[model samples]
Target: MKTPKITIDRIKKYLAEGKRFDGRKPEEFRDLEIEFGVSKKAEGSARVKLGNTEVIVGIKMGVSEPYPDSPNKGNLMVTAELLPLSSPRIEAGPPRFPAIELGRVIDRGLRESHFIDFEKLCIEPGKKVWTLFVDIYTINDDGNLLDAGGIGAVAALMNAKIPKYDEENSRVLHDEHSEENVPLTKERPISITGYKVGDKILFDPTREEEDAGETKVTVGISHGIISSMQKGNETDLDTEMFGEMIDMAEKVWQDLVTKIEKFIK
Candidate 1:
């Protein structure tokens, strides 16, 4: 939807005054809620709500041939489906650019952070290995689906279980009686996106604010280190503004990680 010029102007005016249309501080994030094991069929699942935006992620495990390059390690795949019912902007059809981008961004954060111990997932070196599939669905699209989706994906992975593999039969046992928690690294990585609007930067922007913004930067943080970064939109941020954005992202990363840990535990 095309945002009205007046609305964009008003948002900019509010930001200049160190305020937001939603009455939040520039660095503030909206209320967040997380629920785990939302899907019984899924080996692991989580539902995350940030303000009005909501996303659900499910993790499924299976045995498959190891990749040629990573013969000793398992595989991970992330997919996102933007339901038309979630937003007017999305349409019913195959995965579009936005959905693909969302999945890639989340995948990068998880993979770069090395959150999962892929080597341990190897059922048999260079032969059969455990493959994890993370599926994400948009339930609502008020704004900032990337961060919400990323959170859902990570939370779901943390909740996931490793299905028992019957080596004798060369088959995966999907029954509830034969399952164990998946192994993961001690560090947890989280993604935080900052939106820039006419020299003003904010975290976790709403749909209207995001539509009115010029550019956004997504940073992945793990163990107090940046694992990955991605910038979106055509607008260019000044050097100083870019540094400030990174600092802001780092400041908020700890709180987000703490919140997710609390929920998943």
Candidate 2:
């Protein structure tokens, strides 16, 4: 459901003062909490909460033929479902644009950053390769599901174990896990999203602030470098706004990554 104009006006007034109802700075994110292995069946799973926004990500492995171009490398498939229970706006049906966008964004970030070592996942050159399925589900819609999802995706992959492969049968033994973890690189990508409403910009906004947004800029950063950027909504932004967000994203990554490091194993 759309936020009422009255609430939007209140958000704008608070934003003008560089304050949020939660008392966070314009560029500050809400408290983040992560839980690993939320699903026993999945090879890897995580639940991440950025304030009231929450997303659950799970990783599953399957054996599949390698793509013609990347015969020696495995594949990555990212999917997201924004459940009807998560918000009043969502409906029970096939994924809509928002859910589709969320998957693509996270997939691009992971692929661009080379977060996973796909070559290592190959079972046989030009034949069988491991395909990692990253599934995301929204449990709440307090806003900023994009960022929370990014965190959940990374956490789930890190928490995943390589399911054993039976070479003779060319099958993935889901019940048996290998001792090795998923082949992840040293770099990790995190999504930093900025919302512009009226004359103010906020990161990790509440649902009301998000509904009042004129535009949104989301960037995926790893090791102080931006891997991908996406713009949402109809409002056009000038070069100055883009520049400001880049700077903001870089700085935010430094802080955000630090907070996430403590949870890594």
After superposing candidate 2, which stretches have Cα over 4 Å from the reference? none
Clash count of each predicted structure: 0, 0
Q: Return the top candidate by lDDT.
A: 2
Model 1: ten consecutive residues of lowest lDDT: 171-180
Full-model lDDT for every candidate = 0.88, 0.90
Provide the lDDT at 205 for model 2.
87
Superposed by TM-score, candidate 1 places the C-alpha of residue 188 at a distance from the truth, in angstroms, of 1.4
Error of 2 at 27 (Å): 0.8
Clashing residue pairs in candidate 2 are none
**CA-only RMSD, every prediction:** 1.2, 1.0
Give the alpha carbon lDDT tens digit for every residue of 174-236 in model 1: 765345788789867788899999988998988889888899999988878888889999998
lDDT of 2 by residue, 215-238 (tens): 999899998778988999999988
